[model samples]
Target: MPKILKILQEDHRHHDILLSILENQVKDAHLTGEPDYDIVSAIVDYFLTYPAEFHHAREDKIYEKIVARDASAAEEIGHLDEEHEACEAFIKAFAAALSNVLGAGIITRSQFANAALEFIESQRRHIRMEESIFFPTALRVLTTEDWASLDAELSDTADPIFGSQKEGQFEALRQEIMDWQSTREPANDHVPGDHKLRL
Candidate 1:
C-alpha cells in the first residue's frame, strides 16, 4: 500500500471516530434538551477546516492521477465527487443548525436533531463506500510512477490536532479528541455497528 493511501485511510479512521462521538452527543442533546454546543461547534470547525482544507484536496489531487491512469476509475469515483460537495453542504447546514440551537439563530430542536443524524449517516456511508470500493480500486490500478508523481506534487502538512501544533480555533476539538482517545478502546477492526477507531 502506498503512504498516501495509508494516510487517507488513517484520516478516514479519525473521521469515523469523531463522527461517532458527534452522533452520541447529538443523541444526548435530544435526551437532555440542551445540546453540547461546544462539541458540536468543534466538530463543525474540524470538518469545515481540516477536511475541507486538506483531506479532500489531497484525495482529489491523487484521484486526478488515478483517472489519468485508468479512465474507468473515473466512473467509480464519480459519486465521491458529488459526495465531497454533499459533505460541504451538510457541514454548512450542521453549522447553521447549531447556531440556531445555540440561540444565535432560530432553529427548532427537531431540525437540529435531524441535521445531526443526517450528517452522521451520510458521512458513515461515504467512509464505508470509500473503504470498501474506492480504495481497493485505486490500490489495484495506480502504479509506482503515479504515486511518485503524487508525492512530489503534494507536500506534507502538519496536523494541528493530531500533530505537534495546537491551534486556538481547534481548542474544543482538541479536548474532545484527547478525551475520546484516552478512553477509546483499541481495535479499529470494523464489526457490524462497532464505531470505535484505533488512534
Candidate 2:
C-alpha cells in the first residue's frame, strides 16, 4: 500500500474508535436520561481538530491530484468533494448545537441527544461512502507514480489550520481521545424507545 493509503487506513481505525464513542454516548444519554457531555465534547473536538484539518487535508490533496491526472474522474471526484463539504458542514452545525447547549443552556437534553444521533447517522453514511466507494476507486485507479506524487504532496502540504507541526498534535489528540474512552464504563444502558447500544 502507498503511504497515503496506509495513513488513510490508520485513520479509518481512529474513525471507528470515534464512532464507538458516539454510539456509546447516544446509548448512555437515552438510558440514563443524562447527556454524556464529555463524549459529546470529545466528538466535537475531534471533528474540529483532526477530521477537519488533517484527514480532510489529506483527502482533498489526494483527490485533487487524481482529478488533475484523469479528467474522466472529474464527476466522481466532484461528488466526493461535495460529500466532504457536506460532512464538514454537518460537523460545524453539530458542534454549534453542542456549544449552544453548553454555553446558552437553552436546548434540552433530549434535543441535544437527537442532535448527537443525527450527527452519528450522518457520519456513518459518510464513512461508508468514503471507505466503500471513494477510497476503493482511488486505490484501483491511481498508479504507483500517482501514489508516490500524492505521498510527496502530503509531506509538503502543511496544514495551516493545525499549525506547521500538525502530525505530533494529531497523534496527541488521538491518544487523548483513546485514553478517555478507555477510562469510561461501557455504555450498555438502554433508553426507552431507543435502540440498543451498538458501540
Candidate 3:
C-alpha cells in the first residue's frame, strides 16, 4: 500500500473509535434520559469538517488518477464521489438532528437513535467498500509513478483529533479514546511510541 492509503486506513480506525464512543453515549442515554450533547456535538463537528475537507479529497484525487489510467477500474470502483457526498450528507443530517435535540428537545429518543446508528453504519459500509474494492483496485492498477505524482499533489493534512498537534476542542474526545483503548489493551502490553495518546 502507498503511504497515503496507510494514512487513510488510520483515519478510518480513528473514525471507528469515534463511532463506538457515539454508540455508547446513545446507549447510556437510555438510563440517563439524555446523551452527552457536548460529546455528540464534538464528534459530529469533526465528521462535518475533517473527512470532506481532507480525507475524501485525497481519496477522490487518487481515484481520479485510477480511472484516468485504467478505464476498466471505473466499473470496479463504482461512484466514489457520490458515496463521499452521501457520507457528508448523512453527517450533516445527523448534526442537524443533534442540534434539534439540543436546542428544542423536539426529537424523540428513538428518532435520534435511529439517525445516529444509521450514520454510523453507513460510514462503516463506505469505509469497507473503499478498503475492500476501491483501494485494492488502486493498488492493482495504479503505477508507482502514479502514486508519486499523487504524493506530490496531495497535502499532508493533519487530523485535528488524532494527529500530532491535538486541537483543544477535541481534548475530551481524545482522552475518551485513550481511556477506551486502555481498557482493551493487555495489562502488560507496551504502548507504542507513536501512539496517539503519547503524541
Candidate 4:
C-alpha cells in the first residue's frame, strides 16, 4: 500500500479499462463490419497521453531506480526493461498502422483487424507480466525513501501531452472511456451457438 505502488496501480487500472474498450471495439468491428474510428482514436490517444508518456516516465525514472538499487533483482530487472522496450515498439508499430489506414484507407478492414489483434495480444501479455511480476518485485525491493521519492517525482512531472490542462483533459478522457464501456455490450452476450473464448 505504498504511495508509489498505489499510483502505479491506478495507472494500471486505466490501462485495463482502455484495453477493455479496445477489445469491445474489435468485437464490434468484427460483428457489424464497421470500423469504430472513435474507439481506435481513443486507444491511440491513451498511448500518446498515458502509456507512452506517464507510465513510461514513471517506470524509467522511479521504478528503474528501485530496480537499480537492488542487486538481487538485476537479472529480473534487465528482462523487465527489455519487455518494456518491446511493448513500446509494438505500440509504435500499431499506431503507425492505424494512422496509415486512417489516412489513406489503403489497408483493408481485415488487415487493420489483424494489426489491432496483434497489438492487443502483445499488450495483454505485457500487462500481465508487469502486474504479476514487475510490480510485485518493485514493491518488495523499494524502500520507504524510494517510494517517497517516486511519489514526489510523479507529482512534480507535468504531462507534456496535455500541457497546462492535463488534469481536465484526463478527466474528460476518463469519462469518455467510461461512457464507451457503459454503452457497449460484450460480444459474448449475443454470441450465436456454443461460443468459447479464443484467447
Runs in model 3 lying further than 4 Å from the true structure: 185-199
Q: What is each predicted model's overall lDDT from 0 to 1?
A: 0.76, 0.66, 0.83, 0.65
Q: Each candidate's root-mean-square deviation in Å?
A: 2.9, 7.3, 3.8, 7.1
CA error at residue 73 for candidate 4, angstroms: 1.4
List pairs with backbone clashes in candidate 2: none
C-alpha-based local distance difference test score of model 4: 0.65
Span of 10 residues, lowest total lDDT, candidate 2: 190-199
Backbone clash numbers for all candidates listed: 0, 0, 0, 0
Give the number of the best model, judged by TM-score. Answer: 3
Off by over 4 Å in 4: 156-176, 180-199
Model 3, residue 28: C-alpha shift (Å): 1.4
Ranking by lDDT: 3, 1, 2, 4
Q: Give per-residue CA lDDT, model 2, range 1-199, as digits (tens).
A: 8888767665655565566667676787778876567656766776776777778778887777677767677456456667778878877878887898779658877777677777777777777667766687788778898888878777544432223445543454455455656675555222112222122
Residue-level error in angstroms, candidate 4, position 1: 1.9
Q: Model 3, range 1-199, lDDT digits (tens) per residue?
A: 6788788888887787788789888999999998888888999989998998999999998889888999889777898899999999899889889988888759888999989989998898888888789888999999999988887776767899988867999888777777877765434112112334443
Index of the highest-lDDT prediction = 3
Q: Report the alpha-carbon TM-score of model 3 versus the true structure.
A: 0.91
Looking at model 4, the pairs that clash are none
Candidate 1 local accuracy as lDDT?
A: 0.76
**Candidate 1, 1-199: lDDT as tens digits:** 7777777777787787778678878888768977677877888888888888888888887777778888898687775677789988888888888877777687787888899888888788778878887888788788888887777766567555554565787677767776776786765543233444232
Q: For each candidate, what TM-score against the reference? A: 0.87, 0.74, 0.91, 0.76
